[model samples]
Target: MDDQQFRQLLNRFGFSWSGYRKVRKGVKKRITKHMNALGCYNITTYLAELDKSDEVRKKCELLLTVSISRFFRDREFWKSLEKKYLPDLIDKNIEKINVWSAGCACGDEVYSFKIVWDCLRNSLGHLPKLEVIATDINPVYLEKACAGIYSSSSLKEVTEELQSTYFIKKKGKKRFEVNALLKKDVIWKTHHLLSDPPESKFDIIFLRNNVLTYYEDLLKKKAFRKILDSLAPYGFLIIGSHESLPFEPKDLIAIAPHSFVFRKEAE
Candidate 1:
């Protein structure tokens, strides 16, 4: 299909321009397959066919969903969260702590947070009431995440200590199983970042690599504002090392190097 029609088709599914470019590379094949299944030849005809049928819409969504992830993909970021942010947060409140792992593909990052919390809890003797909300727009990935089974490839960045402590060796394979205790603290749900209201304010919001890069400047600003608004006083916002919010609000204090941590300055 032409660029305009292609853009509109993807936009209808909540994808942005950057998203279209990132996905268009591999997606053309899937689009062709879906088109073949629907007996259409081009993206224009394929989208038209999909709009006419709910089954085709579902098929298209399944084809378009992206789920690339790994445990502790940025090792230093997790270390900083554990050593600096979590301790600071723990010191502030022992009763409640909320962490949101936005765009948590296959729940690796959610489990990573749980692992960090468990380590701190062991050393601290008592821990805050910790809750990790893991969200993704893809229902299929959310289901796999909730199932808590992962391939060894997904755990490449997981440290040896964590592998030994939090995962049991699966029989006859390179994969390790996620501990059940960590799973208890994490809640997986399908959430559309652009359309859905922030369900609750979080003490730490991990809106990592993928979602930040998939929008124009205006949408990026809106996303940053929304994420900031959902953060509590002294809350943390961690993005990919390369991705940054368009404008830094005065309220958000930079945490050196790359990260930004904010304290609520006004209601």
Candidate 2:
């Protein structure tokens, strides 16, 4: 599909053209493959097919997904999580800590948090019981997440010591598998950001690089509000470093200027 055709598909689904612009080449390829699979000769035919079937539309959305992530993606942000925000969170919530990894692609972000938490625990003795909910709309990504294996490229930001501590290298393979220890207390679910959040209030919600990056303003605001509502008092909401909120939310205050970390102020 061409840029104009892709933009039409994105507009119909409330996705952002600017957000997908840089990565549209690969996404367009995926959509074109999907179109061919559906026996569509052109964008007009594909759009009609998408309108006629809910499943077709959903499949198209999946095809549009850009799953570009790596462990400790924003290294500075991860440092803040490890040295600053999380330490404060533990000080307040001495009993249990709940975290949500929204749009957790292939578990990289979720496992990154777990690694940080683990390192923190070892340094400061036992921490509060931790529970993490990692959600994404794509089941294929979740399956890869559950498997816990990753390519060397995905571990680029991961330091040697951290890598040794958290992952197991397979024989004759360049892939690394996340240690089983990090997998515990993590619940992987197929969830849409537009839907209601998981049952519990979260101490930390990683909404990075997804809703705010992909969706239009209306959908971004709607989903952002739901995410804000799910944050516990004084909880932190982390968005992609390059992303910004669709509108100013009175309840959230920016904690870090360089990174997109915001803290929920008490209501």
74-136 per-residue lDDT for model 1 (tens digits): 788788777877898788764789888888878888888888888888877788787788888
What TM-score would every model get versus the actual structure?
A: 0.86, 0.98
lDDT of 2 by residue, 185-261 (tens): 99999999999999999999999999999999999999998888899988998999999988888888998544489
Clashing pairs in 2: none
lDDT of 1 at 171: 93
On a 0 to 100 scale, what is the lDDT of residue 190 in model 2? 97
Q: Which ten residues in a row have the lowest lDDT in candidate 2?
A: 251-260
Model 2 residue 16 CA deviation in Å: 0.6
RMSD (CA, angstroms), candidate 2: 1.0
TM-score of 2: 0.98
